[model samples]
Target chain A: MPLDAMTDVSDEALLVLFANGDQMAARALTLRFTPKVMAHAYRLLGNHAEAEDVTQESMLRLWKIAPDWRQGEAKISTWLYRVVANLCTDRLRRKPGLALDAVPEPEDNAPGVTERIQDHTREVALQKALNQLPERQRQAVVLRHIEGLTNPEIAAIMEISTEAVESLTARGKRTLAAKLAGQRNELGYSDD
Target chain B: MNWGIAMTERKFDPVDLDHLFARVREHPAQPSADLMKRVLTDAYDAQAAVTPVTAPQLPGAPWLLQVFRELGGWPSMAGLTTAALVGVWLGISPPDGLVATADSFFGTDDDAYLIDVAPEATFEIAEGFLQ
Candidate 1:
C-alpha cells in the first residue's frame, strides 16, 4: 500500500499490509501513531527525549506484533497506549524518587508572553502533581483525563475490567485533586 | 401543607467533578515539530529493525521453518534411514538360515545331542556334526 493510500485504510488493515513487507504501510503507521504515542509519553515522562524514546520503543513493539495482529481484539491506539504506559512505568521504576520538579527548563527565547507564562506555571504544577501519583493511578489518570480515553477503552488498554478502570480513575482523580489542592488558587482556577 | 414542607427542605447535590478537571482538557502541551520528527524517525528506524526481511516466499511464516519443511521433514527422513539399515541387516544374515544352522549343530531329534555316544560312552565324536 502506498503511504498516501494508507490514509483511507483502517489502522488494522495498514498493520496487515505492514506485516506483508509493505514499507509504505510501515511509514504510514508510524506517521499516524507517533504523535499520539509521543504526547502520551511526554505527559507521562515529562521529558521530550524520554518521550521520544518511549514512542519509538512502543511503535517498534507494534511493528513486531503486526504479524500476529488480531483484528477487532483491540484498537491499535489502545494497544499503543498500553505499550507507552508500560515503558513510562518501567522508566519510573528504574529511577525511583526522582522529582519532576527537577526537570530542567527549556531555554526561553525571550521575556515571557502572557500565554507562555501561564503555560509554564501550569505545566510545572501539573507535572509535579502527576509525578506524585502512584504508577497505576498516574497511568489511569493520564489515559482517562489527559489523553481523553473512555473508561472502557482504558480498561481494554490496561487489561482490566471497566469497573476496575472506573475505580482507578476515581482514585487517581481524588489523588490529583488532593495533590493540587493547595496550588489551585495559584493556578488561577477559583474553586466554587 | 406539602408546599410548606417542600420549601424548608435542603438537598445536597454531588459536585460536578468534570468542571474541576476542565482546565487539563484544554491545556494539552504541543511538542515541537523537531521533537516529533526525531521521535518519528526513531520509530521508523525501530520499525525497520522489527519488520521481518522479506524472503521470496509467504509472509508471516518463519522462513527457516518453511525451508525445513521444503527440504523433507526430519522424522520421515530418519524413519527411511532406519528402514534401509534394517533391510541391509536382514539381507546380510537371513533369519531362517541362521535358525537352520542352529538346528543342524545339535541334531533334529527331540532329545538329540550334538555328540554321538558309544554304548559305554567311550570314543570321541567329531564326524560331520551337521548330519
Candidate 2:
C-alpha cells in the first residue's frame, strides 16, 4: 500500500503489516514513535546523547518484536514508554552521575534573547529540582506533569498502584515547590 | 475553623509553575535525523529476516517432479504395497504345469509319436491337430 494511504492505520495494524514485510509500516512506526520515545527517555535521563541511544535501542527492540507483537493487547506507545523508562532507570542505576552538560544548549538567535534566556534558566532549575527527587517520584512527576499523562497511565508506566502514583506526585510536587520557592523572584514570578 | 480552611485553600495556589511546565512541554528533546536513519535501517534488516521468500515454480519435468515431491514422492508406499501383494498372490496360486503338458502332447524324444510316420503324414497330422 502507498505510504499516504497508511497514515490512518493504527499502530497495531502497522505492526502486523511490518511483520508481513511492508517497508512503509516500518517507516510509519519510526516516524510515529521515535520522537515520543526519545523525549520520554530524555526526560528520564536528562541527556540528549544518552536519550538518543536509548531511543535507538528501544526502536530496535520494537522492530525485533514486531513479528510476535500481539494486536490490541497493549498500546504500542505505552509499551515504548515502559521500555524507555526501564532503559533510563538501568543506566541511572549503573552510574549515579548525571552529566552537567545534559542541560540543553541555548539558541543563538539575536531576537527575543532575554525571554529565551529566562526560559532556559527556568528549565535548568526545574531539571535540577527534578534530579534531586527519588527516581520513582521523578518518573511520576515527569510523566504526569511534563508529559501530561493521566494518573492511571503514569501508574501503568511505573508499574505501581494508582494510590502510590498519587502519593509520589503529591510528595514530588511539594518538594519541587519548596526547592524552587527561593527562585520565584529570579524566575520572574510576581511576589505573593 | 473558617480562618484555617481559608489558609489551606490559599496555600494550594502558591507558586506559579506555568513557565516550568510550558518550557518542558514545549521543548521536548528530539532525536536527530541520523538516529532515525539508524532505526529505519534496523527495521529493514529485521523485516528482511522475518519474511520468507518463495522460489518460482520451474517448468516442464521439474514442475512435475516438484508436484510429486510435494505429494510425498511418486510410486508411494501404498502403491509399492499393492504391487508386492499382487506378486505374492501370483506365486501362491500357481497355474497348471504348462511345460509338462506340452512335452506329453508332442513327444519330447526317442519314443516320439510322430517318429513312425512319414514326414508328409506327420505334417498332415500336426496340421489336423492344430485345426
Candidate 3:
C-alpha cells in the first residue's frame, strides 16, 4: 500500500507491524506522526532548526522502541509528544541565552498585511508569551490549549495530576494574557 | 463572613479571557518539509536498527523452511544426540568386542612370547611358530 494511504491505519496496528520489522509500517508511522511532533517542537523551542532536530531525535527514539512497544499501555502519539516536549526542555536548558522572542518568520516573501496580521500572529505572540512562563507551565499550556489534549492526557504527558495540569494551564494563561495584553489591540483583538 | 463572601463573590469572569485566548489556537504553523524529512529518516533508521530480524523470503525456501535450514535440519540434532548417548554408554561400559579382539591378538602366554622374542629373531621362525 502507498505510504500516504497508511494515514487511516491506526497507530496500534502500525506499531504492531513495526514491531514485526515491517519497514513500510515504520515509514508509515514516521510520515504520520512527524509533523505533529515537529509542530510541537517548533512551538516549544521557537527555533525551526532546533525543533527539527528534536523532532528527528524524538522519532528516532520512537523507532528504537518500536520492537518492544506495548499496545494499550499508552498511545504512540502521546509517547512521542512527551518525548519531544522533554527534548525541547533539554535544548532550552542547554542554551539559557536562547530567548523565545527570536522566533523566525516564514521564508515565503513578506506576507501582505492581511496574511501577516492573521490569527497566526496571535499564535506567535501567544507562543512567545508562553515561552516566558516557567517550563512546567509552558508545557501544560501547550499540551492543553495548542495541542488540544484533554486534561488527563496533559497530566499523563507531563507526569502530573489532572488538577496540576489545570492549575498550570490556568496560571500560564493568566501570565500569557497579561504579557500579550499590550499586543491585543495590535493583533486585532481589542473590543474597541 | 457572609458580608466578606458577598464582597469577594465579584471577580472578573474568565469567559472573556477564554474568548480572547481562543484566537491564539487558530493558526499553528505547519512543519517545514526539510524538518519532516529529517524526522522520518531518523525514525526509519531507528526502527530498522531495533526491529527483530524475522526470517526473510528466499526463492527455494519459505521463511519457516529457511529457518529450519539455518538450524541444520531436525535429523542433525537427533543424530548428534544419539551419537552423544552412544559415546556416554560406551565410556561407562567397555566394549566386549574390543576386549575380545585384544585377548585374541595377545594370547594368555603373551608374556612368555615377548620374553623369548629377540632382535635377531628371524621372520622364518616367527612364521614357523604361527604355522
Candidate 4:
C-alpha cells in the first residue's frame, strides 16, 4: 500500500505491515513517532543530545519487537513512552550530576515576536524547575501536564496506579508553582 | 516584582497551572534530522534482524527418503508405486494372446528342467563307474 494511505492506519496495523516486510510501514511509523518520543525524552532527561539517543534506542526496540507484537496487549505509543522513560532514567543514572544545566537554551531567532520570547523563556524555566523534582514526580508531571496525557495513560507508562499518578502530579505542580512564583512578574505573567 | 512573601504560600489552581503547561505544549521540541536519520537506519537494521530465514535443506537423510522427496513427496510417490506394481502383475499374468505375441517376437519358450536335458549322456557317463 502507498505511504499516503497509511495516515489512518493504526500503529498496530502498521506494525503488522512492518513485520510482513513493508519498508513503507517503517517509514510511516518513524515519521509518526520520532518527534513525540524525542520530545518526551527531552522533558524527562533535560538534555537534547541524550534525548535523541534515547529516542533512537526506543524506536529501535519497537522495530525489534514488531514481529512478535501481540495484538491488543499494549498500545504502541504507551510502550514507546515507557521505554523512553526507562531509558532516560538509565541515562540520568549514568550521569548523576547532569542536570538542567545541560538542557539546551531556547532558540531566540525562530520565535521573533516579543510575546513568543516570553513563552520560550517560560518553557525553558519550567524545564529547569522540572529537573529539580524527584524522578517519579517529574515523569508524572510531564506526562500529565506538559504532554497532556491522561492520568490512566501516565499510570500505564509509569507502571503505577492512577491514584499514585495524581498524587505525584499534584505535589509536582505545587512545587513547580512555588518555584515559578518568584519569576512570574519577570516572565511577563504579572501583566496577565 | 516578588509579590512579597505571600507569593511563597500561594496555591496555583488548575486554571493557573494551565499557563505553565501551555508554554511547554505550544513549543515542543522537534526531532532533528540527524536523529530521524539514526532512527530510520535502526528501523531497517532491526527489520533485517527479525526476518525469518528459511532453514537449509535437510542433509544426511537416508537416500530412499531423499528420493521420496525428489519424486514430489508422498502423494506422487504413492502413485508411482501403484503403477510399478501394476506393471509387474501384467508381466506375470499376461493376456492369452500376449504370450503368443511375445513368443513370436522373441522365439519359443524352451523352459525345461536340468534333469530333462541330455539324460542319456548322463547315464552313459555313469556306466563306466558301475563296471
Candidate 4 residue lDDT tens string, A1-192: 554368988899999998888888889999999999988998988788788889999998999899999999899999999998889888888998775634345566765567766776777778888888889999999999888999999998889999999999999988888888777777777533
Q: Candidate 4: misplaced stretches above 4 Å?
A: A1-4, A99-112, B1-10, B13-16, B52-131
User: Model 3 chain B — which ten-residue stretch has the worst lDDT?
Assistant: B7-16
Q: List the residue pairs that clash in candidate 4.
A: none
Name model 1 segments beyond 4 Å from true: A1-5, A99-112, A190-192, B1-131
| Model 3: reference contacts kept, as a fraction | 0.52
Q: Write the number of the candidate with greater lDDT, choosing between 1 and 4.
A: 4
lDDT on C-alpha atoms for all candidate structures:
0.72, 0.82, 0.74, 0.83
lDDT of 2 by residue, B1-131 (tens): 59988776446535556558777899888889999899999999999898977556667678786766676654575687788998888678756885467668976776675566566666777779644
**Residue B111 of model 3, lDDT score:** 60
lDDT of 3 by residue, A152-177 (tens): 89988888899989899988877777
Measured by C-alpha RMSD in angstroms, how accurate is candidate 2? 10.5
Give the per-residue Cα lDDT of candidate 1 at A151.
Answer: 90
Clash pairs (backbone) in predicted model 3: none
Clash list (residue pairs), candidate 1? none
- Cα error of candidate 3 at position A123, Å: 3.0
Q: By summed lDDT, which 10 consecutive residues of candidate 2 chain B come out lowest? A: B9-18
C-alpha RMSD for every candidate: 14.4, 10.5, 11.7, 12.2
Q: Ten-residue segment with the worst summed lDDT in candidate 4 chain A? A: A99-108
Residue-by-residue lDDT tens digits, candidate 1, A1-192:
444557888999988887776767767887788778877887788776777778767877887788888889889998898888889989888977544535444456756665555555666777777778888888888888878888988889999999988898888777666666677667665534
Error of 1 at B70 (Å): 19
Q: Candidate 3 lDDT, tens digit per residue, B1-131?
A: 49866443223221234544566455555667777677666766666666546555777658778767677767877887899999888778867686577668876565666675555556767778644
